[model samples]
Target: MTDNKQPASNVEDPAMPEDVTKESSQQHIAKDNAKTLKIRKVTNIILLVVCGLFVFHLIADRFIPITDLGRVRGFVVPITPQVSGEVIEISVIPNTLVQEGDVLAKINPIDYEIALQTAQQNVTQAGQNMGALSANVTASEAKVTSAKASLKNAQVQSKRIFAMADKGVMSQADADNARAELSSAEAGVASAQADLAKSKERLGSEGENNTNVKSALLALEQAKINLERTHIIAPTSGVAANFRLKEGVYAVAGQPIMTFISSEDVWIEASYRENSLGNMKAGDDVEFALDFAPGKVFKGKVAFIDYGIDWGQNEQSGKLAQASGQTGWLRQSQRFPVTITFDKEIAKGFKRVGGQADVIVYTDDSSIVNVFGKLWIRLISWLSYVR
Candidate 1:
């Protein structure tokens, strides 16, 4: 009875605690498996989404090409003076609009004017000299004709006197005198002819065709042209930019004094990756945004695609081709310029040459790609504000 009563604490089963510990470990393992499975599923989903986006971008890039490397371009003309002189007047203000043929500035025309006047006088004098030469030629011809007639008479008289002397019908002295007269007439004729030929040589061609007259006329024309060039007329309808010319400033011939940007020839130049230009062609629809006018998208069309680039172009130097090495795994893509012309007039005062821009071309009518391009360009336009 004593032993059974004392063993109450030891009566419990020893395997029960071990079983409980084993069950707890099993529960932890099950929980860990569940968590790992969940994490795997999440990672797979993320990777799938990323791959899908990459594929979509590739397809969009092929059909709907886009580029942030764009610029507004126009006829950027250098306002150079054709005549060198002191600037006497500036008719147009800096950055002001001017019409074609409008005078932008004036060079001192005094020297050119005096040159023109002198040229005119030279032309007049040449004409007068030509008239005198013609008269001299005519007088020489008349003298030659009179001498030839006298020579004919003298030849007949000499022949008659010689026949009479041979027949003994006239004195030998008379015959000798006749022969002397004939010789004198022949000499006169020869001198007159020489004078005529010399006069003709001096006259050259007649009237305006004369060499001296033509030279004078050319000088006069050049003088007139030089005088006209003193007035610097606008080459095209555009704005006179950076007009720093002032009165009394010396302007050198062919040296640019200012800049002229043509308004009518405004366009956009976009540089796209070479792979992106495969399907693009002229007349393709285009959308562009300029940094100067943020949040505004303008419509345009593809004017042309440049056929060549300067990169990797070697001049005609006789040397081995220099090939560049690529150290990185991925090679850089070459870019080409595509010209875009506006479909309509751009907003006034917004067109500026060399302005940064973004552009996109719609190569096909694929609604999905086009819609995405439209949205993407608009988004870029809005982002331009922050940029």
Candidate 2:
């Protein structure tokens, strides 16, 4: 009774009770638990969505392969001269279209013309020499015939003279003279035969078959070819690019003076991950969007797939094979190139070589993944406008 009256601070207030404080703490904990549960549920939903997307991509990539690493490719032909000469005329303008056999340039044809004339004259002289050789051969044949007749007559005369001398009807001097004449006739025939062989050797076969005549004809033909080559013509239908040729410029043979981008053969080269090409094959349908022409999709078909890449190639440097070191836990996938040919002609102005593009291929016609691929490529086409 005395302590209660003395210490008012020791007494508990009705408004601040222990049970009430305990109840308030419990309420706060329940609210925190509810909030934590809600956060956990949201986190689970996000993880599930991400996993589902990853799985869908894996499945879709197999049937509908896509690649943003695509480029427009065309046959790049080097415009080079076959004969070195001063460029006298440039017939084509830079970045202009040309047809096959169109004159691209003209070299100094004066030297070639002179050479052609010289070749013609040489051919004529060869013909004259061949005719002379034929005449010599005929003359030698006639001489041989005459010598043979003389030899036969001398033989008969020598035999008659020897018989007369043996019967004492003719002098020994007469027999000796006849023998000398026979020997002379035989020498003449041998000389004529040797001359004939020499003439035949010089003449070879008659007419164009003669070695000298054939050589002259070949030289004339080569001169004509060189003269024609002076007028450089386009090898194929293409657009002339990187033109550096000008009048009076010394053009060297086998050196590229300009670049020719062939319009006849244009394709897309798409690089795809190695794992995504299992079902991909030539003749698959393809859709591509060029960076140059935004918001437009082009139709194409798979032309071919590259079988090999330059990586891991033996450079033949006579060194140890360099093992590429990888640091990460997951190795990076290798990419291979796939060629896609266009289904129709592209506008001549839009056909740029080495242009960028986004490409997708449909390996299966009935695959649902193709629907997504089609949508994705169109999306890429529209997106290209902003990029």
Candidate 3:
């Protein structure tokens, strides 16, 4: 026992014990560090995804669509009368639907029919006159032939008498008479040739723009116009608008007895914010919300964009300057108008008549960004739940 107690004074195996303890402590620390590093990596990845989504959402204005008035549109119509006549019957009323060539009114055909008959009579008379003229030309030619024969006989007689006079056997007066007759015959032949030329000119084909032919054609045209006027037809297929016409109403030339609105050419004119213009372009996908049907949404593409803003009567900001010589300033928003037309059957479902509509324009390209935004939203919602 005394000897064992004496070992306190002696040096123990310090290196061996110290090495074992240090090794055990280091192993524990390394295990803890590996776990901590794993947790930190997972947290960093989650944060990076969240940040990406946040950025995408902030810039989604380029991709996410906004609504505007740039999509509404319509068409214009000009009222025209096909013929001039008294209105006898009217078929379509105001706002009535009509197809192409549909009758709108009727005109009295009696006057036109009479005019046609008169024209026909005139044509026949002209033909008869031409025949008579031809016979006259033929007679003039015969006269020329007779004149030549007489002139030849007179010349022969003149030569014979001149020979006799030279020989002192005939008088000079007879020879002079024969010479005068021959001269007269030559003049007559010339007149006949002139007459023949005139006849040929009359028989020539009339050019399309010939004044006389045009006049005759105009007569035929008038007859045709009268016939067409007997039935007043719509120029195009559309709905009758502002029509005050009825049976027995007198219609004048260049007067609008009725108006027509196109049924199939309806469109939306939408006004978009200037700030929302960056992402919007022609042919962009769009959604429409009509003012009439608040719940219904229509689909269309951006058909057009205004080149500039138009601020009517009231001067508003960002209105494009009016063109030179434009009239009075009316109070209206000076915004660029865009045209949008619906192609789907859904637009038909809504009762739209010059209806007001708003549009959402889309302007972005990255699907990954959209996905990131979605994930971020989900994460935010989950975090809120956790909280």
Number of the top-ranking candidate, with lDDT as the measure: 1
Candidate 3, which segments miss by more than 4 Å at Cα?
1-61, 68-72, 197-214, 291-296, 312-334, 344-353, 364-387
Residue pairs clashing in model 1 are none
What TM-score would each prediction reach against the true structure?
0.83, 0.85, 0.66
Model 2 spans with C-alpha error above 4 angstroms: 1-49, 312-322, 327-329, 344-349
- Using TM-score, rank the candidates from best to worst: 2, 1, 3
lDDT of 1: 0.91
The global C-alpha lDDT for each of the candidates, from Candidate 1 onward, is 0.91, 0.90, 0.66
Error of 1 at 34 (Å): 12
Model 1, stretches more than 4 Å misplaced? 1-49, 308-323, 327-329
How much is the lDDT of residue 45 in candidate 1? Answer: 99
Model 2 over residues 219-272: C-alpha lDDT tens digits?
999999999999988888888888766799998999988888887788889999
Alpha-carbon RMSD of each model: 5.9, 6.7, 14.1
The alpha-carbon lDDT assigned to residue 219 of candidate 2 equals 95
Instruction: List pairs with backbone clashes in candidate 2.
Output: none
| Clash number by candidate, in order | 0, 0, 25
What does the lDDT come to for candidate 2? 0.90
